[model samples]
Each structure stands twice: as C-alpha cells, then as structure tokens.
Target: MNGPALSIQTLDKVYANGLKALDQVTLEVRRGEIFALLGPNGAGKTTLIGAVCGIVQPSGGRIEVFGHDNIREYRKARSHIGLVPQELTTGMFETVWNTVSFSRGLFGKPANPLYIEQLLKNLALWEKKDTQLRMLSGGMKRRVLIAKALSHEPDLLFLDEPTAGVDVELRKSMWAQVRRLREMGVTVILTTHYIEEAEEMADRIGVINKGRLIVTEDKKTLMHKLGRKELLLDLYKPLEALPPSLAGLGLRIAEGGMRLVFTYDPAQENNGVVSLLDRLREEGVKCKDFNTRESSLEDIFVQLVGDS
Candidate 1:
C-alpha cells in the first residue's frame, strides 16, 4: 500500500518459437496514478501484461504487486490486481448482473448487491443488468468487461485497449469512469492505440518497442523534452525556395511554396525561431500571417517508435 502498486524487475519473456517478446523490461506503476504504456503492433505490450497477470510465464524475472512477490506469492500478488483484457471474454449467455457478480465472487469477495448496483449505475449499465452479453452492442460489451474488472475492487487495474471499438462519446464516458477510479485511489496501467487518451489522462508515460522499454517519464516532461514545436508562416507571395539568409534555420517551403515551416525545439536554448524571424525581416520576406503548433503525444510516439 505504501510502495509501488506494481514493480517489475529485469523482466524477460521468450516464446517457444524463440521469439523474445520482452527484453529486460523493467517498470513500476506508482500508486494512485495513471500510467500509459504505448507501443506499436507486435511490440510486446500485451505480452508484458500477460506475464504480470500470470497468463504467460516469463523466461526470467521478478515481479511484485504491492511488495508481494508475483511468482513466490502469485495468489496474494494477483488478488490485488484486476485486468480488462483487449478481447471481450464475458460469456454470451450470461446476464450483465450475473457476470459482474460472479467476477467478484471469484476473488472470494462476499456478495454486495448494493455495491454492484452502484457500479452498474455508474457505468450506465443499470438498465441492462439483466440483458445477455450477446444482446449488447460492441461498446456496451466493452463496458461490461470494465464492469467485470472493477467488480473485485482491486487497487491496481490494467485496461488493455479498453475503448478500441467504442465511439467518441462512449469513450469519453469511460475516460470519466477511469478518472473516478483514480479518485478512489486505484492505480491504473493502460495500454491504448489512442495516443490522445494517454495525453488526456496519463500522469506518466512509458514507451516500449521491439521488446525493449525505450523511455519512461512524467507526461509533461516527456512531451517537453521530445516533442517539437513548429512555426508556420503564411507568406503573402509564393516562393520557390527559402531565402539564403534563412538557409540554416531549418525552414522548408510547403503548401506549394505559399508557406514556410520552421521546425524547432522550444525546449532548446537556441530553437532558431527568433533568428529565423529576424532573418526573414532582413531578407525582405513578408509573411501575411504565422502560427505555432506544438507536437502532440501522437507525433512524439510516431517519432520514438519509428526511431526505436
């Protein structure tokens, strides 16, 4: 309760096909914070989660959940965690209420109909509690998976692409639900294809690629360090090439030469932006308008994963 919600040390996992899915991947999820794990396809995001949940055995490593050794004390470590997997695993014939109620029972938790009722209400599933899983929409089914995951009331929760098929509205609703969970002191580790989701909610971010943990840092710090900002100048007249005076300012002609794009790192001491503006004035280049844009988490993710 006082230490990390989950701690993984030198984690290594190699499949029987001789594919090494994880390479000395080490990470820790802080208590009561939302940590986002970002990666591309076949990047072992799920494999790492599987290893922690005891669904896949690691070739070598040690894991601890709330300071309890994962391997040496698997049950104790597992009981404090909950997983909402990528795929929907709830039974088609089971009613929503029964499915969630049964999940809580699996953890040896006593039946609490009042708590279950509140959970369903919070998720907007109260009306459909008696409906079978097969009758629900894709988004509704996904919500059921979340309901099942939360049924046990674990301190740490892993949501793997939790809103993949959901619409924008429903996705926002789930995001609100996740915030509520964090407010209740649940430490969440989320893997998502939607980089904006991480941008919107994650307190910290971790990037994994090619079976290796590439970087981990506070969300804002990561963005400030790796994210670049661009200043786009809308020229009054089209130019075939950049002015000679602005050659080294990282300026490029775009929009059929109607615009000048100056890419710079705002975090750097000399971002070349000020010099570029001064040179434009000295070189008789006139711009009707100019605007700056900071790279989003998606841009940084693409660059990081691409380079990794």
Candidate 2:
C-alpha cells in the first residue's frame, strides 16, 4: 500500500501504420486516488490505458501495477487491474449477472456469489441482473460495464469515459459512484470528454496532448497556479470608452459597454485589483454590482489544449 497503484516509466507505443500513439510517457497513480487524464481525441489517452491493461504492448519502457512488472509478471500485475473500456464488447445475449461472473472467471477467480451480489447491488444493477445486455438502457449498460470491471475485485480500476453519453442526472450519479469506489480503497484512473466531471471528481489531473503529458498536478494547486480571476463590475451607466490609466490593468469593456471586466492573476504578489478599484473611483465609474470568478478547470484545460 506504500507504493503507487500504477507506475509507468518512459513508456512508448507505436502502431504499424507509423503512428506514434504514445511517446516516452511517464506517470504514477497514487493508491486510492481518483486521477483524471485529460486529452483530446487521438491524443493517446486510450492507447496509454490499453498499454497498462495489456491490450496494447508498449514498444519500449516499463509499466508496473501494484509493484508487479506488467510484462514480466503479467498475470500478477493484471489481476490487480480492471479496465472499463469505452466500447462495450459483451455479447447482447449475455445476462448481466452471467457477464460479470464470466469476467471474474476469466481472471481465474472462483465464483463468489455473495461478493457478486453485493457488487451488483452497490452498482444498482441487481434488479437488472437477469436482463440481457441489449435490453438495457445506455446508462444501465455503462453500470454493467463498471460491475464487470469490479467483478474480480481489482485494486486499481481504469474507467475510459465512464459517463460519455450519460444524461446530467446519470452523470452526477456516476460521480457519486466513483467517490464510493475511492472509499472502498480502489484506485481509479479515468479519461473523459467532460472537463467539469474531472474537475468535480479528480484528486489530481494530468493534461496529455500530442501523445505527451504536458502537465500533472494536484487539482487545487494547478488551478491556483494557472487559474485567472475575473472581477466583473456592473456599471451604473454605460461608458463610452476606457481611460488610458485603466488600459493596462487587463480591463475589457463588455455587456454592450455597461460592464467592466478586470482579469488578473490572483496568485501574484500584487494583483492590481486595488489599483483598478482606485482607478474606477477616480473615473467616477460607479458600479452597481461587482463579483469575482476564478477560472475553472475547463478554462485551464482549454488554454492548455490550445484549439484542440
């Protein structure tokens, strides 16, 4: 438990068509932490996950899961990891219970009905255990996927876009479900199209772009380091233009020139918010209301991805 749940050092993956899917990737997932990997399509997020799960072999470097080398000790390392893939591969004719049970058996685990029962109940799939996969809704199918991943009781789980097409309510439900997994001491690594979901659930975030990891940091620390604060002031009257002294304070006239937006880095020693306020007073730009908003994870994500 003292070691990382998953670790990769100088990992590289190249495809037959000369596509470099992964390039010298290095990362570690702390035990029991929910680490979100953010990236665009074809950014190697899925390729990275596939390499660790053994579906795709790396061309070079090492991968260790729970202290076992993924290639040398494949069985031991794989037994501790469960992957919930983006695509559903289960047969349409398979019942939920049987499918999940089959997954456990594939891992060489003896049938444990009690554990399976509890798992199904926890994932809210108990009632649908007898139903075929094709008969279930998309959200229910996703739940079955999660149930299958946990069937063998893996210490580390990979969720590839767990709630990709889920409704708002279902997305929230999945967020709570993920939190419960963390409570059960299951380390989770997830990749998602929704940055806000990552913001809401992740303990740490890693931004991957162009098959390379650009940044990885604690959520709050990352936000503080890159997040900007916008102070929006609702004016009492519309202003024709900005004064010269107020120009350099990152001021922008918005809302049809009725509002003043002051953008600044909140982490700086002197952020210039006080100076902006003083300038507003000098210009007699009376504000009816003012509110400050910190940049969201989505904001930083967009900035980092840069047109992705």
Candidate 3:
C-alpha cells in the first residue's frame, strides 16, 4: 500500500495478424489515486487493460502489480488486481451471492460471507443477493459485476467504462462509491469516453492514440498545458466580408454565419481579445452579444489525437 499499486515498463503488444496493439506503453498508478485513461475507439485502451489483467498476452515488455510481475508471478499479480470489464457476461442462472462468492474462491481465498455481504451492501446489491442474474435489471447486473470485482478486496481495481448505459442517478451513486474506495487506499484506474467523468473523478489523465501513450500528467497540469479558451461572438448581422483593419486578428465565423469564434490562451502575456474587439469596433463591425467557452476534456482529447 505504501508503494505504487501498478506499474508498466515498455509494455508492447502485437497480434498474430502483425497489428500492434500497444507500443512501448509505460505508466504507473499510485496508491489511492484515480487514474483515467482517455482515447478514441481502437486506441488500445482495452488491449492495455487486458495485458495487465492476464487476459491477453503481451508480445513484449513487463507489467507489475504491487511488486509482482504479471507474467512470472501470474497468480500473485492477478490476485491483487480486479477488472470489471465493459461487457456484462455473468452467468444467467447463478444467484448474485453465489457468483460473487465464487469469484473470491477463484483467487484461492477462503469463503468469507461477511466480506461478500459488506461488498453487496456497499454496491446496493444486498437486497438482490438471492435473485438470479437473469432476474436483475441491466443496471443492477452492472452493480453485481462491481461487487464481484471487489469480493476479494483487491489493491488495484480497473473499471472499463463503468458508467456506460447507466442512468444519471446510478452513475452519480457509483462515482460516490468509487471515491469512497479511493479513500480506503485502493488504486482505481478507469477507461472512459465520458470527459466529465474523468474531469470529476480523476487525479491524473493519460491520453492514448494509435496504440501509443501520448502523455500522462496530473489532471490540472494536463488541462493547463493543452486547454484553450474561446470567445464566441454573436453577430447582430451577417457580413459578406471582413473590413481591412481587422485583418490581423484571428477570427473564425461559425454557426452558419451567425457567430464568430476566437481562440486564445489566458495565461499568455496578451490574449489580444480586447485589442481584437477594439479593432472590430474601429472597423465598424458590430456584434449583438458574446460569451466565453472553456476548453473541456473532450476538446483537449480531440486536439491531441488529431495532432498525433
């Protein structure tokens, strides 16, 4: 618990078809921190998770879970890791309690009904413990997956799209639970497309593109390094052309000619937005109203992946 919960060193994966799924990927998850992995489709997010969980074999490199090498010490490493996959594939005829308890036994842990009961209660699944998996709703089934993952009290938990297709209320509740898990000193690593989820829960963010890690930094640092602020100008009237004096200002027309957008960094010496507006006035250009838009995680993802 005092050291890194998970570590990857030059991890690489290549399929039999000669396609590279991961390229020299290296990262670490600190104890008690939420680490978010962000990427577009086919960016190797699932592949990376698979390798660490002992599902998919890596063509090269090493992964360690709490000081145990994933390949050499498969059982010891895997015993410390719990992965809740994106898909719901529980046995339909199995009762919730049976399935969760069985998962703990798979890791060679003795049956501890108390621990399983507590996990079910924490996930709000205790009431449905006797019900069969098929009788549970989609959201409830997802919660069962979470309970199974936590049955053994793993030191590191991987949540792959944990909130996908879940209702707003349930998603909020799940995030609160995850925060509590972090407070208990468990490392949480999640892969998600929901930018707001990462923005809200993650202590650090790692962006992957084309099977390679673009960068990994503290959430605030990543935002400050790549995020841009935009000023949106709602034009009172559409103009066919721009005036000569406003030529130096970088302004883009958007929303089918109904708006003009300008992008700038607020931390720079001069944003030039005030000067741009002054120049627009000097050139007889008018606008009805204006608003500012801050760059979101999605915006940064788009920019980074697009550049790569």
lDDT of 1: 0.88
lDDT of 3 by residue, 1-308 (tens): 46688899999999899999899999988988999998877889999999999999999999999999999999999998888999888799999999999999988899999999988987888999999999998778888888889888897999998897888887888799889878877889999877778877899999888889999999988777767889998888886665676665777778877788888888887889989888878877788999999987577788889998
- In order of lDDT, best first, we have 2, 1, 3
**lDDT for position 41 in model 2:** 83
Candidate 2 regions with alpha-carbon error over 4 angstroms: 230-263, 266-270, 275-297
| TM-scores of the models, in the order given | 0.81, 0.82, 0.81
Q: Report the poorest 10 consecutive residues by lDDT, candidate 3.
A: 239-248
Worst 10 residues of 1 by lDDT: 241-250
**Which regions of candidate 3 deviate over 4 angstroms?**
231-263, 266-296
* Local distance difference test values of all predictions, in order: 0.88, 0.90, 0.87
